[model samples]
Target: MNVLINEQYDIYHVAHSGVPLLRDVKQLNPDVIIIDIESPNRDMLENLNKISQFAPKPIVVFSEQQCANTTINQMVRSGVSAYVVGEVNQKRVKSIIDIAIARFDLFQTLKQELAETKQKLSSQKSIDKAKRWLMETKQLSEIDAYHFIRKVAMDNSQKMDDVAKNILSVASIF
Candidate 1:
């Protein structure tokens, strides 16, 4: 485990003790979560689901009994990025944390990029409509209409999509 203990303290290895680690998880914002539950209590697994919902971090699981498979599978479905077995040997905790954290970071990056792309696409549609309105009312060419919105954005130091919104708002008032 010492080999896996990196300089960055971004991983939290905790046990299920009837205490929700939501606050700690958020404060740590750990890239990886290693949960060790010595007791297969139903409440503990339920608590894991709740934790996963509140703070979705990469997770690797270990239990006292191998029969915890169903709950482990449920955890994976609930945003546990990676799942593995074996006890939480203090000697190996650090290595497990490192691997899970790396995988979680990659997944988060992709999720953010996709969300940004969707936002841009939605804004493009709004801008296009404003451009079309300019073409009809102002009798401008497509390129000129687009440039007109861009010019307003530059003058106001606002986003092009915001300028388009204002254009639509004023036009709609009539």
Candidate 2:
């Protein structure tokens, strides 16, 4: 680790943890974390997973032993972005950090897109339910029901989904 910490990049903080590693990482807010371990045990992998949920950052793990398929999958799921099964050297450290950061960024982008898609789907479902409620209760056509909901949303300066939810709530009371 010392060899890699030179003019290019210096270590922000050093910590050895059996537990509570996530707390330290959250406080440090380092750009990347590099873990040098012979082979990660189940406890270590679980810790990494927990850390990923709360304090997400680029993680690079250098393992001395060749990792099994399951080990690699678990580490990836647990938020280790770059898992290299080999020795590390001063020259290689910078490249590894760059790769880890790139991979982490890609993962974040994909996650954000998935979340957006799900939100859109949920909103659409709610809007459809509200449209159906209006069609049945108000004796309006589907298109008119949709227009009424849109007008209410625009007049109230609320999102369509919020307006839809309001309509559903009021309809359910009767």
Candidate 3:
């Protein structure tokens, strides 16, 4: 492992009986992480999930045999970028890392875009609810309702989404 890693890039190895903390890895700030584990235990997998959420980095896991499909899926979902089940060698190291990094980046981008889309949908829902409230209670046209929300947002220096949410909350009691 050292021979393969040492050829192209510097390496840092932290030995631990249990799972290493995410902070330990964060401090190193490696471009990619390579873990050679005979079998990834439940605690290790859980720690990987926490690490993925806290400080995302491309991770390559080299194991002797593939675990259950559910476990493999969980690892991927938890940010294990590449899982290699075979012998590790100098020839394969760089390519595996490259693939892992690429996949990690793609996954992160997708996750971010999905979050943004969901936020936009939530905002639109809020705006629609507020507009419906105004049309029912104040007898305003849809256009008028939208204009009122926009005006309030502008006056208060807030986002239209925020203003819409405020309208819904404030009008809820009445």
Candidate 4:
């Protein structure tokens, strides 16, 4: 694996024995990671998960042991972009690395989109709550309340959700 990788990419760091994996990965910040193991263990999976959460990178694993579907799922959840259960073929190494990088890129895009969608939903909820409060306190219609909030937000160069939260906080005081 080292020889094959060295031909294509520069080896940033190699772990021979008793090396801290996560800390090294965070510091070096490699473009991708490849691991050869006899079998995937719980500790390895946990470390991979932590790496995924902190400093995400495309990971490819080559294992001699045939694992169950559950194990494969766990590996994917732990951020293994590519998992091969057989003898490592030199011919396939390049393709495998390419596919792993592509998968990782797609996963990151989807994750970001999901986070933005959740934020939008939360902001809408806050805006709705503030509009309801305005209707009750100021005797304004829903559309008028929305316009008022929008005007305030535009005037102050702030987000509507932020204005809504401020209104809610003031309402809570009374």
Candidate 5:
């Protein structure tokens, strides 16, 4: 394994156990992580999950033990980029690492997009609620309320959502 990896990439810290996985990862800040294990235990998976949540990186696991489908699913959900069972082929190691990196990149992009979308949706909901409040209390039309909010946002150079939030807060005082 070392021979195959050393040929193409520089080796970082190597752990004989998974106990200090997260700490090592945080300290090393490696671009990619490769784990060679006989089998993944519950603790190892938990550590991997923590790494995924705290410090994300592409992870490739080469294991001699065959894992169940559920275990594989758990690994993927825990942010493992690649999991290979049985003996490692020297020729395929580089390609495996490349694929893991690509997969990790794609997943991160999708995750970021989803978060942005959620934030936009939340802001839209707040704006809509504020508009409804203006329509009901101020006796303004929907278009008028929207324009009022937009004008206020433009004047103050603030986001429309922020203006809407302020409107709601003022409304709540009444």
Candidate 6:
């Protein structure tokens, strides 16, 4: 918990069993969770999914059970960090937490970045297709069609992609 907060995770509270961990997490709105459970807790996972549906975060679970592939898969699908089972290594636990948080952070950033890039690429493709349509219909050169599209984009104070999408829609109708 100390390391998590130090790493800028904004851990709100360190909760123990017999207490409402799920409720506390929802109220506190933590960025990540680390659980030291003797066995898998289905309720915890369900509560995590409920909380994560709207606002997702990292979850780590440390258990004293046997390290099996099936259990690992289950825990991950249930929203948890690597299920480090058997033998407690304080240093290793801390290291795993650090790695898990870092990994989660990177995954989120990469997903956003990739989505943006894909959107741009998709828009560019549409714009190019629209320009090609105008060129064929007007018998205009590629450069002229591009400049014409650019002029319209600037005149309307709209993005080139938006203008291109409009062009595509109009051309498709005809």
Question: Residue 86 in model 4: shift from native, Å?
Answer: 11
In terms of lDDT, model 2 sits at 0.61
Clash number for candidate 3 = 0
What lDDT is reached at residue 126 by model 3? 99
Q: lDDT per residue, candidate 4, 34-148, as tens digits?
A: 4433224324533665646543322233332433455445445535444322244534654655444445546668889999999999999999999999999999999999999
In model 5, residue pairs whose N, Cα or C atoms come closer than 3 Å (at least 3 residues apart or on different chains), thus clashing, are none
- lDDT per residue for candidate 6 within 62-139, as digits (tens), equals 333434456445545433353322345646655555555555455557778999999999998988998899999999
lDDT of 1 by residue, 1-174 (tens): 112245644334543344454455445554434432223333443355454654332233343243345644544443333323223353354455445445445565778999999999989998999999999999999999999999999999999999999999999997
The residue pairs that clash in candidate 6, if any, are: 59-81
Off by over 4 Å in 1: 1-92
Could you give me the TM-score of model 4 versus the true structure? 0.53
For all the candidates, what are their Cα RMSDs to the real structure?
A: 13.7, 14.3, 14.2, 14.3, 14.0, 14.1
TM-score of candidate 5 versus the correct structure, residues matched by position: 0.54
Model 4 residue runs over 4 Å out of place are 1-87
Q: What lDDT would each prediction earn against the true structure?
A: 0.58, 0.61, 0.60, 0.62, 0.61, 0.61
lDDT of 2 at 131: 98
Please give, for residues 51-111, the per-residue lDDT of candidate 5 as tens digits: 4654332222333243345544544553543432334563464465544444554666888
Each prediction's TM-score versus the true structure? 0.51, 0.53, 0.54, 0.53, 0.54, 0.53
Model 3, C-alpha of 145: deviation from truth (Å):
0.5
- In terms of lDDT, the poorest run of 10 residues in model 5 is 55-64
